[model samples]
Target: MDSFDSGGVRIAYIDVPAVGGSGDPVLLIHGFASNHAVNWVNTLWVRTLSQAGYRTVALDNRGHGESEKLYDPEAYGSEDMAGDAVGLLDHLGIGRADVMGYSMGGRIAAHIALDHPTRVRSALIGGLGMHLVEGRGLPAGIAEALEAPAGTPAPNPTAAAFRTFAEQTRSDLRALAACMRGSRQTLSRAEIAQIVVPVLVSVGTLDTVAGDGPGLAALMPNARALDLAGRDHSTAVGAKQHRDGVLAFLAARP
Candidate 1:
């Protein structure tokens, strides 16, 4: 594990060489409240991408993992988080590379692709979709649950859901609440339409959190969707079909 300071906050990350990978390097970004380990390495993504010939790079998106923690909502913004990813690339002297992200990370990936196209070769966006248009903010009270004093019950299902996930991952609940409040930036259709990099929008068929995957793909100039049949947002991450789609898409891109 390695880390670097971006602005005043320290961010944790890992960069592993693909022993025999012949494909373009891949930068892996994990989801909200989840670090590189729980979201990527433990899920076999690092090994999978590396074995397939991709030098894998991943990071804990500021408030998660061993990175610096900021509990104030103003301290974490989706654009700032996206900037963290770009900053990591800059720190490593990487001109550009393929970028892949899931869920909240997917939103950050979209920002990177749309706002920092020259720094991204292509994007593999999973667990996110047309909801990028329908809505982008965390459901009301979700953040509240994270910030609530320990032992206080969450006020809503949305809050409970995230609160439980945070507990499961042993995340800093306060930092996650701040993240939710600040990381809600979204791309308008016009913005997405301008992204030139080929994109693979994959989501579980049952993922309500992501909305319509195919619909989101239709909005992009160069994009496609991969359906993980019966998978939901949580289960889709480990689905073999998702892995196959990524490999096939990456292999087919120029």
Candidate 2:
């Protein structure tokens, strides 16, 4: 884990170099309530991308991992999050790079491509969609369940992991909810259409959070969709099929 000061906020990230040699840098952004290690590292994403001849850079988005978490709801806006990526690239002297983002990170990537086109060469968005501007369709009981404290000790690590991830996120749940709400109002198909970079829109077949994969793909002018058969949002991130599809897309890029 390396650290860099991006516009006064301390940012944490891991830079994984390609196997053969340095290649096009690919910045990775993880989802909500998860850190870079949890979302990407544990999923073999860095290894997969590096092996495919791409230098992978995964960052702990503010408020999620080792990065500083601002309590102010206003700080969690997509523009602010997108600026962090742009700031990181500027700090590192990277002019432009391909970017891949999942879930909330995917939303940030869209904003980055829309707002900072000169700094983005291409984009791969997963676990999310342009249609999800209003936020993922959360279940009715989810909000209540998330707010309530754990009643008993978890039996297994997987259960414990879920609790821990959830607890850590509760620190700024209101901010998170607000950010999701604001994202929908801030992002639009017209804005997305302005992005000229090549894009790959990927979603799990059972991903309820992102809505229809093809519907989201239709919003982008230069985009294509990749469906991970038989996989849900959580499982798709680590699935071999997902990695293979991403690699194929990256390889075909100019």
Candidate 3:
């Protein structure tokens, strides 16, 4: 576990090289309000990928985990966070690697695929889908809820739940609030159509936050979509089928 300076921000990350066997390296970018451990490691992605013979790298985005807290909304856009991913690779001297991002991480991954396609060999986007084309994922009140007093009741239950989840994760409330606003950058249909890297978009069949995985995948030039049966956004992360799909996708490519 170590930290690197990304545009003056201290971004924390964990880089585990290949062991037992050797294969292509994969970079794992976590979802919003999530750290590397909770999003990837805790869910056995690191273990699975390592045992499957791939080097793994994961990072805590700017406002989450042990990374520097930036309360400025402008400091937390999808592209800026994407830069942090590239910064981690630069720090590790990695030229290009396969990438997988979940939820908010999915958006950042898309940004990287669009802006720095050469840096990514392939990408797997999960916990997201047509929402990337339609509208913002989270509600507007989530930021306000994060800024609310710890015990204050929120009119929006979804917002309150997120605030509670953030507190449970020991996140900086203000910074998370700023992140909510800043990371709302979504890809338009035209932007989605422009991504050239091979991609796999997986989503829970019941996930409301991520709409129409198949539709979104159809829009991308080189992408496929998979549906996890009986899963939702939070539950889809730990799904066995999702892992298989990712590994299969990577194997299907170079």
Candidate 4:
């Protein structure tokens, strides 16, 4: 584990080397409430990318994992999160890199691409879409579930994952909820079109969180879509189909 000061916040990260030799740097950003280890390393994402000759860096976002947690909802806004990624790059002396993110991380990646376009070479967004800004596309009961008490026990595997993620990150449920509400105000479908980098939008066929992958792909000028058949949100991360699709997309890019 390594730490860097990203705008006064201590950002935690892990850099994994490619198997054979160094390649274009790829930064992996985890979803909301998930740390670098849980979201990427534990899912074998580092190894998967390294095996394909890509150096990988996975960072724990502010308010999650070993990174500094600022309970202020204002600090957790998308702009701040995007700055953290750019900060990491500046600290590491990386001028540009490919970025891949899942869930909330995907949203942050979009901000990075749109706001800090020069720092991003390409983007891979998983488990999210522009529709989230609109209020009607999420899973049937997700909003209700998120609004439930922070300490409430989960009833199933999916819920269990969320609960565990929230607890592990020591996230302030109230602040996170506020941040979610605040994000809707800043997100825009028209802004998504401004990101000109090659993008790969992927989601499981059964993913409820992202709403629709094809819909998201259509919003980006240079984006491709992939569906991980038979897998849900959680299962798609390390699944063979998901990895193959992402790798194929990356390989096809110049």
lDDT of 3 by residue, 107-162 (tens): 89999999999999998999999998897566668998899887888768788888
lDDT of 2 by residue, 76-130 (tens): 7788888888888887778899989998888889889888888888888998864
lDDT of 4 by residue, 150-240 (tens): 6665555554566565666666555454445444334567887888899988888888767788887788899988888987877887788
| Candidate with the greatest TM-score versus the true structure | 3
Give candidate 2 regions above 4 Å deviation: 134-136, 139-147, 152-164, 167-186
* Backbone clashes, candidate 3: 0
User: Candidates' lDDT values, in order?
Assistant: 0.88, 0.76, 0.90, 0.78
| RMSD in order of candidates | 1.4, 4.1, 1.0, 3.1
Ranking by TM-score: 3, 1, 4, 2
Model 1, 1-254: lDDT tens digits are: 79998987898999888866455678888998888998898888888898888888999998899889998777777788988999999988889899999998999999999889999999999999987767743568888888788778988776788888899899998888888888877788898899889999999988878888999999999999999999998899878898888999989987
TM-score of each: 0.96, 0.86, 0.97, 0.87
What lDDT score goes with residue 161 in model 4? 62
**Which residue segments of model 3 deviate by more than 4 Å?**
none
* Candidate 4 wrong stretches, greater than 4 Å: 130-161, 168-186
The true-versus-predicted C-alpha distance at residue 93 of model 2, in Å, is 1.4
Model 1 steric clash pairs? 21-53
